[model samples]
Every structure is written in structure tokens, then in C-alpha cells.
Target: MSRDGTGVPHSGGAAYLGMPAFPRAAETATRDDRLRANLRHATHTIRAKRARAVAELDDWARLRQAGAAIKDRTLRHLDHHLVRLEEAVTRAGGTVHWAADAAEANRIVTDLVRATGEREVVKVKSMATQEIGLNEALAEAGIRAYETDLAELIVQLGDDLPSHILVPAIHRNRGEIRDIFRDRMASWGRPAPEGLTDRPAELAEAARRHLREKFLRAKVGLSGANFMVAETGTLVVVESEGNGRMCLTLPETLISVVGIEKTVPTWRDLEVFLQLLPRSSTAERMNPYTSMWTGTADGDGPRVFHLVLLDNGRTDTLADEVGRQALRCIRCSACLNVCPVYERAGGHAYGSPYPGPIGAILTPQLRGLASPLEESLPYASSLCGACFEVCPVAIDIPEVLVHLRERVVEGGEVTIRGTRTTIKPAKRHTAERAAMRAARWTFDHPGALRRGQWILSRSRRLRPRRLPGPGRAWTDTRELPAVPAESFRDWWARTRGGTA
Candidate 1:
């Protein structure tokens, strides 16, 4: 990890740091017709398959409600559940570590790997590790982390960022992946086969051959869990590929970095997520590989296990009543599949490991709206509510987006670095606030509103089809609504023959 001039530490190649705000990034992405095409094709296909998969379950809505309720209940007593989980893991011969932030989490993982004396560790496509930039942190510590998941491997080999949640390299076509494999696989480990083509089976075969060597040779494995059972200290990872299973079982030392919100009270709570996750994410009735481990076993799996429970702003997010609901997210990426804005803007535009509707609300809350990048995330959505409809955990993303927008437009007290401080609204939103205030005043006074409407009616012909000055951007893609010849009040009074 390296610090910028502001003394702020960044990792994972600082992929998202100093990024332009969402609107600007989105504008640039919209111009990339190729990127837009890739996103549209991929998201549409996944959403259609998911819709059919979801329709198969008659009690899906009930399951969704149950999942949401379970998450909420666990969050309500999170401290208790965490303590219980730690005790359970300890009893099961696993060491549990708590990290207050990303830096701490990275340090713990690095030290654990260093102690194992392994220079390279195989990974299980864990998002929690990505969130904290663990791969970059390990590299800084002279430890190499190899991505075993095929999409992640492609992204790593190509020197690119993940654009989608479930499928990180969603922006890349089969041809691009083949090219990446042919050119870059040798440097990483195994070389691509001679005359490699873009066929899906061929790509999978090359990735498998390349990763199999790393999996067999590595002594340490790194992972993130989809759900952690508090009662039994078992961690669960669901995946379509067998790479996760290999990472979990093949290595002698295993380390899992997981968000604190992943904890559930019992195994019964786990069953709901299992049903909802696979169908929502991969459109499968169940994942091909469902790996679970409860610490260690005698002469089986990893001999040593370390569980790093990461906070990293989750407690702060919990303080917010409206924003806390984002913690219920299961990382299914169903929202991303259904989001129209994400299809057009692409995941790179959001500038986070998480993309699409879930990212719009989750990123801002987890990091706080401290910078332009974080502040811009809340406005990334179009509020079509498709995200909420498809969410397995029933997170109301649009509601949170609107809430965060209010936070950006009218700054308020927020907890930063454990300090309570009030943040002022951004200077960019001053004109917007002024416009809203003027409209509010006009609506409050009946005579003022009547006069304003009468003036607008009389000057209807003079009104420009497009707005001028700072407002021109709003009208560039949308026509200004034409003014009517008379106000609704006039029509009502004239027809009723009373107030006139």
C-alpha cells in the first residue's frame, strides 16, 4: 500500500483514486460504443436467465422477506453474534482476528502469510479481500497473490479492473480474453496453448491448466465467505467454478477475510441465503461448488485456519437508520443485471470493486461521502426501482440513493475516523439548493405561484426549447416541457364558475 500526497493510503493499484465523478466518468463511458455493447449483451442475458430461475420458486418473495429479516436481526445484535462466532471458531481450533479498518485487515493477512513463509498464495475470488485491496498489499509485502477464478485471472493478466460483481471481467468479450491469455499467461505462471482461440471451452481449458499448477504448489489459501455461521463457526463460499473448492481444501494454511455483516445467527439462517444466492447470481438452482469449513479437521483440509473479521466502516454504516439496510446485500449482483444505467455507463464508471445499483448506495455508505468519487455514487442511479425488485435480500437501493443525495445536497453530522463532525453541502450543489428553495417559496405563497404561472403562460412562445447557462446540460438530452396557454387553476375556475 502507498500513500498519496494527502497522506491517504491506497491499494489495489489505486484503481479508483482521483477518479472523475460519476457523471463525468459515465459521459466518457457512454461514448465507448464497444463497452456499452458488451455490458448490454452480458447484463441482458444474465437478467433473463435469472428471471426464469426466480419464477420457478413459488415462495421466493417469502424467502426474500425471511432473508432480509434474518440479516436485520443479526445486525441488531451484531456484537453478540460476533462474540459468539469468535468463541465458536476458537473452540473449533481456528484463530479469529478483528480488524477495525482496511489497513489493519491487510496487515493481519500479510503477516499471517509471511509467517507461513510462502511467497505466493492462491485466492478464491473473495470480494472482501478486493474491498481492502489485499492483493496489492501482499505484493507490497513481497508476497504474490494469484487469482484462481477464471474471470479474475483474466482481469489480473490483462492489467484491468473488475467491472461486474459476479463476473468481474464482464466488459471483455471472448476474443479479448483469448488475446489476454495468449499474451499474458506465461508471465503469471502457465502459458496459453499454441494457437489459442476465443471459444469459451478453450479459454476455460487454458485457465484451468494455468491455475492447477498454482493450486497444487501453494501452501496458503485466501478467501472470503458468502455467509458465516455464528452458532457453528462455519464459513460458506458458493461458486460456479471449482477453483474456490481447490483454494479451500488444497492449501495447508487457510485465511479468510470477511465483512462483519456476513455473520448470521444460526445454520437455519444459512439455508435461506443458499436458496436465494445461486439463483439470483448464476441463474442456477444451486451452485456447482459450495465449500464450507469449520476451522480445521484432523488430517483433512488446512491444518491452520485464520478468520479475519473486517469492520472497515461497517459499524459507522450501521449508525445510519436508512443506510444500514445496505448491509443486507448478499453480493448476488442481481441488481447489476437488471440496472439499465449500469448497462450504459459500465462498472468502471462507478470506480469501485462493487458496481451497479448495489454499489451506488453501498460505496457511499461504506466509505462515507468524503470525496467527489464517494459523493457522486449516490446519484449514479436512475431510480427505476428494478434493483429493489430483484434484490434477494430486499434492499431498497433507490430509497438509500435518495437519502444519500439529501446528505450530499444538505450536509449533516457524520462520523469520520470515529469523530463526529458536521460536513457542509458541496459547493457544486449550491445552485440546486437555491432553485429548490425558490420553488418551495413559490408553492408556499398562493398569489406568488399564480403570478409566476400567469407570467410563464404569457411568455410561453418566448421560452427556449433548451435551457441556457448552467442548466443547458439538463436540456441537452431532454427537451424543456412546453408551457401551456393557461394555468390549471384558471381552467378549473373557468369551468367551475366559482373562483373566477
Candidate 2:
């Protein structure tokens, strides 16, 4: 690989650029019967497993409470804890770099890889890395970044975007995966067996065989951490597959780019999350593999370790008092599993790396509501609050969703890329906004409210079940409420005879 910092590699549309609004993206996904079946099976299976796993815990609520509190305290004293983490990492003989955003983080990692003189790096599944488009950026720099996780490997092989946070390829069934491997695996590194079947064992064997050489040959590894314990300067990654273990240990030079929000203040705080995360995410009493490392240890794992603390949009997200709670997310993706919207519309519709209920609120706030996609994201949810109930850290996703919806409709001042900018309400929503304002004005005046009700009642027969213009699209699927023949106030007046 050759590198001279002329320009950063374009991450391509791999990072959710130029995508249409949520409804449009969703419309395409919902049309695919196969995709719907895949999501339905995966989500239902996981949802049942998670509920059973969580039910086994007597102190689940307490554990959840502690997790939320710990994260809140950590975020409140985030600066202090981060400094402590850096100090601890340094004390343990590791180098730490701080990046304020994706571009800088990419540059730092690219430079670090260049310094190591390696053209290829193996990766554990890392949403943080994916969000920053690190792999594409590295590709631009002529470095090949391999995704070692099973689902991630499928996504990488198919040249597809991750459809789920926990299971990136949740949208893909086994048959599709076999086809992906049979056709695409050879091009990347290894080819599937002569007759690749979609059987679980066969698929696993194929992936294992294909990735073994890469694991042995790779000199550099890149990852994102699930939790960073400040007290011990230790980082943890929990996974079902042992691939993460290999990615963490086999490589000579390891670079971890992690969102700063993954930090916890102490070992006790870590304990609370350890209980909550596994059950919430994998629905296992404990994840099969929990890998922990402190900086670089001689003769055990990598000889060198670099931790890139990425703040991309975190500081800006943390600025909003109401929106800041999103930083509490542990990336367990419990919320995604239980989401009705995600099950139907799929993950790609929400756009960006984070999807489902989390992305609806988190992406817009993190990226800001400047674009149509971002603005449309807040409305993606039904506000059912299933996401909130399942969140291990007790984040109020629906509350944040509503808060962001207000941000979008009202067009207020918001911070983006560390600058305060006033955003205008979406032009597409102008009619809706006007209608809301007019309704509010009528409700505030008794005479007008009564007059409008009378007009509505008199014109009731002429009313259409479907609306006119843009509203017709919404009404096409949902039946507008049946208009009442008379207003409740009129009934009260007529029945009670205006006196008794």
C-alpha cells in the first residue's frame, strides 16, 4: 500500500450518503418478501430469547438501574474519566490519540497503519469503525481491511451495508449467505467449498476455513470497544464467535477506535453493565467470549497498542440536555430487536450505522437534522416506547424521538460540527406545519373552535376518508378517523339542556 496524505479516501456511499427519506427507503425494503421473512424470524427469535434470559435474573431491574446511573455519572464526569483512562492506558505502556470527528480519526488510523508499514488489517466487528467509514478510507489509502465477524464477513463479501447493529447481516438468510460465499468469497480471499450448502455447520466451516489464513497472516488489527473501564484502563469486547478473540490477539499491531461514550467509571460500574449487556443483546446469561486487554502486554497479545478515542459527533450530542441521554447506549442493540418499525421496514431505511429506534433518535442528533434523511429519521418511529423498555441503560428513546421531532418541525438553532446553525423546517412539511398552527389558533379561541366544529359537522357528508395532496399518501394506507356527526361539547350542551 502507498500513502502520502494527498486526500482522505472517499468512504463512498458506504456511509449512508445521498439516501432518500425514511419512507422511500423503507418502501423498497418492505416490498421484498424474502427480506421481511428474514427480519421477522431473526427478530422474533431474538426477542423471545432475550425475554427468557432477562426473566432468569431476579435483580434485572436493579441491574438496569445501576447501569443507567453509572453511565449518567460517567457522562457527567466524562472529561475526568477520559483523562483517567488516557493516563491508565499510558501507564500500561500504550499510546492514546484523541480525534474530534470521523475525518481526523481516519487520518490518525491511516497514519498509524502507514507508520507500521502494513497494507492490510483484520477487524473485529466495530460499529464505531463502520460509522467513520474506516475500511473504505483505508481502501482509498490502498490498505485492505478485512471484517472477521461472520455476519460482517457476509456483508463485506456481498458489498452490502449492515442491516442490524448486533447482527449486521440480519436481513440475509442462510441460503443467501451461501450464495454470497459461493460467488464472492474466492474474489476476496478464499473460495467456498465445491458444494456450499446453507446448513449452519457447513457455513461456519466455510467461514472458519476462509478466515484462518487471514488471521494467521495479518499484522495489523482494528477494532471498537464495547466498554472502556476507566479505573483499570481496560477495554472489553464480548462476542459469540471466537473471531473477535483472534482479531484482538493474533495481530502484531492493534489499533482500537472507540466512541468516547463507551466508558464506565469503575470495575463495579463495569459489573452492572456486564450483567445487562449480554442478556439484553445476545440473550445469553453470559456471552460465550468476553475479551479484556489493558494496553499492551508483553508476549501475550499485540506488542504495540494504540487507542483512538473518537468524539466525532459525541460532544455535540452531549451538548443537548435532553438529547445527551443517547450517549448512555452500550450498543447492545436490545432496542433494535424489539422494534416493530425495524422488523417491517428493515435497518437500511433508518440510514446511517445505527438503526431501528436508536438510529431514529441518535443519528439525527449526532449528525444533526440538516438533511432530509436526518430530518425524516425522527418520524420513523411509531413512538411505541418498546425501545425504551428494552434499553439496558434506560435511555428514553421515545422522549428523544419526540424532542427531535420538535427540532425538525420547529426549525431551531442546533449545533453541527461544533458550530451553532439555525435549521429551517423542511419544505415538504410546510403544509403540515401550517395546519398545526391553524388548529392551535382555533383551539385557543372558543368562538372559532365552536364555529370550526359546526362547519366540520355541517360539511361532514362531503368529507373524504382520504386527504387531498401530500396527505393522501399517508391516508392511502391508514384510514383517517371516522368524523363524528357532532362535537362532544355540542352533545354536552344538547343532552344537559345547557343548565342542569
Candidate 3:
């Protein structure tokens, strides 16, 4: 309060910690009119455009099927393709590093940066870097990470968490962005111009000017690839802005951190995804800029190139028979744009780098259902199947969500950190388990069930509108159907005068 009058907001790139369960988070977000308006407008606009774009292609379904099939095949033989990828990259004179977890990935990147003798890095918008919290790690080692993407720059300045995957700053409108830039831009390196209005052109110009110096001076750059071709070792990055191209080409040292699942078996397999992703995510026939590079080139771009393949918790996710289908996600985020739950509840509630319907199922499996937030994520959705319909790779998100929910309620042996551990049912779910068991036993005894039903029918008037215990809150929003005065079985028997 004494230092800067404008309060310091939390960093958007910071890891999510101590987050409440999805219901609580979603409740808070629903009360926010601004958040609701922003989400409603953005999601509807993108989803509509996506529909139009997809309808333009006669073979879009075929392309989607091909994309799904390629990813599935690559996943089954991931070890072989990953090795082939490594060999191809090595042949192209690039070094490759494998990171089994987030900490290892961070350490590898930090070491590589320190080795470069540069304390600053210009970054293209890479979800992999965000997933590993690389920027924060770099700061710990006394290196500054500069975001080159305009939206990312706003997010970095605002000290906010990304509310969307593709457009990280979708939560904020232009006025909010202008305020962030005016207040925080100078602290970084450049300041917004005097009288900087919130006009799009003015904002764009200001951002361009602010980032020009960083681009020209940056010696190191880092990114995430949309797809990696195993056959040729090419990393493909598709972006609407030209910032990615600058980051890829201008830096003396280039580092790309990619998820193992991002690999496509061949360039032909790569082609299918290229067609699906742009239309699904951006609603464009093709993104304005698409960059593909095969390792380091001779005096052409980055003299030194390094590829870090990150596993993190992916192997654990792959181990889940039902949940592993999430690996097919191309991250188009069409699901997010179409999801009614996502439109209302927003992304941050998911408590992972990935959010929305994908996050609901994927995060729980990737991180395991140990934490309250992770466990609750499985039940965050209504399983309406919009996400399933919109997915480019055809991941059955609802099926996975239900599967994970079953695992949560009926906990058994779960592999945590590659070690098998038996997990007991959560204490909160024990009542539900007991109720279900009681119902099962009653169903086994027809006479007892009939008697119980008759008693309930006789005392129907005395029953409370709201149920007690765990059902209170559930009944708060929805009413239980009124019980009939007489059991249907009794009515049938009286009318027929015989056991039909």
C-alpha cells in the first residue's frame, strides 16, 4: 500500500494452490456479472464461428477421424515414435532432453538458459511452459521471462490467472487491459503512451512498441509446439500473431518444450491435425502464421536448438484405460467454447493449466484423485456431452468423467507416483455408499421393499419438502417429486383384483 497505489494482483502464471473445490469456485464465478458476460460473449462468438468454419469443409469429419486415429496409433506405439523423433532431431544437430516431471523440466530449462549466458528470454505463448511454471522458475534463477504475445503480455502485467486456454486473457476486456498496461507496463521495461485510449489500434501499437526492444535484444527464446513430426523431427507452431515467428527466428538460442502426446507419426498424420485445429480453435481456414522448423539450421535461425519432451504426469494419465482418451486432445478448445458448464462456471475453477470440459476429466487423472480439488473435478460437469460433440479428436469426455467418478466413490488400489497404494473411500462418500448398499439389500427382498414403500406412501403428508444430511443442498436448487398417496403396485393389485 505504501509503495504503489495500484494494488499488486496475483501472477496469472503462478501455480494454482489452495484452491477450493469446483462447486465453491464455480459459485463465486457465477456471481461475477463481468465474468459471466465475458464468458457468455466470447464462448458464443467462437462457437458460432467454429460451426461456420467446420461446415465449409465437406471432409471435416473424415479429417477429424483421421486426426483421432493418428493420435491413437501414435499413443499405442509412443515409445517407438519418440525414439525415432529423438534420432531425427539428433541427426538435425539439435539436443533433446526428457523430463519425467515438472521440476525436472524447469531445472533443464533453467540450466540451458544459464549456459547461454543470457539472463532474459523472449517467449512465445506456450502452454507447456505454463504447465511447468517455467517463467517463475526462471525468475528464481535471476532470469526475466518476457511474454511476446499481446494477450500474454496483458496477463503477465495484470498478474492474473488464465481463464481460457487459447485466449488466456479472455476474462478481461479492453478497458481492463488498458488499465493493466497503464499501471504495470513501465515496471517491466516499457510504459504505455500518454493518454493511451482503450482503442484496439492504440493498444496494438502500444504493445508493438513495448515489445520491439525485447524482440531485438532477446538472445534466447522458448516455445511449445502444436505438433511434432516424428519422421522429420519438425516442430510445428500455429499462431495468429507474428510474435511466434519472431521468437522462433530471432533468438540465438531456441528451446521448445512439448508434451509427449503432441507427436504425430508422420507429416501426413500432421496434415490431418493442421486442418482440424485451425477451424476448431480459431475458426479460420488457416492461421495467419504457421511456423515449422527442423532442429537448428546453419546460420539461418537459432544456432542452437534444444527440445525437451515433458512427461510430468502423462504416463500416469496414459495408464488409465478410460481416461487415456484425453491424450487425443489437440487442444483446439472447441469443447470449451461449446460447453454450457464452461460458459457459466468458466476455466479457473478446474484448477489446472488445462480447464473446461477437458480439464474436468483430464486434470483428475493427470494429477491423480488425491486432492479435494482433483477429486471434485470429476463431478464438475453435468455430462451433457457438448464437449464430446465438439472435440476434434473425439475424446468421450463424459465417459471418462463418469469413469473417474466411479473410481472416486469406489476407491481401491491406485498407483501414486508409480507406487501402488490402496485408497479407502473418502469419508464424505461413506454415507452415499451406505445408502446405496441399503437400497441394494432392500431390492433383494421384495416383501420388505413393498412394506417400506407402503409405509412411506401412508406417511407421505408428514414427509419434509427438503431432505436432511447430504441431500439438503442438492434439494435446495431442485425439488423432489411429490410421493403418491398410494403405491403403484397397490393400485394395480386393487384395480385388477388379481396378481397380473
TM-score top scorer: 1
Clashes (backbone N, CA, C under 3 Å), per candidate, total 0, 0, 1
- CA lDDT, every prediction? 0.85, 0.84, 0.82
TM-score, predicted candidate 1 vs. hidden true structure: 0.85
The TM-score between candidate 2 and the true structure equals 0.85
lDDT of 3 by residue, 1-500 (tens): 11111111244555777777888888877766677677777776787788889889877656766777898899998999999999999999899999988899999999999999999999999888888899999999999999989888987887777767899878777888899999999999889999999998999999999999999988999999999999999999999878999999999999999999998889888678888999999999998999999989887899999999999878777777778899998888888887767777777777777889998887887778868998889788865556776788879887787677767777866666666677777668766666546654775687987787677667766868788999996544333223445444574457532322
Worst 10 residues of 3 by lDDT: 1-10
Please, what are the lDDT tens digits per residue for candidate 2 over residues 1-500? 21111111112335777777898888877777678778878887898799899889877766777788888899999999999999999999889999998999999999999999999999999999999999888999999999999999988887778889999989889999999999999998879999889998999999999999999998999999999999989999999889999999999999999999999888777778889999999999999999999999988999999999999889889888889999999888888887878887888888788999998888988888868899899889875556776788889887687678767776877888888788887777876676546544765677986776677666865768778998986544333223335544565467532321
Give me the candidate number with maximum lDDT: 1
lDDT of 1 by residue, 201-274 (tens): 99999999999989889899999999999999999999988999999999999999999999999988988999
Alpha-carbon lDDT of model 3:
0.82
How many clashes show up in model 1?
Answer: 0
Candidate 3 structure, TM-score to reference? 0.85
Q: Please rank every candidate by TM-score, starting with the best.
A: 1, 2, 3
User: 1 or 2: which has the higher lDDT?
Assistant: 1
Residue runs of model 3 more than 4 Å from their true location after superposition: 1-12, 431-500
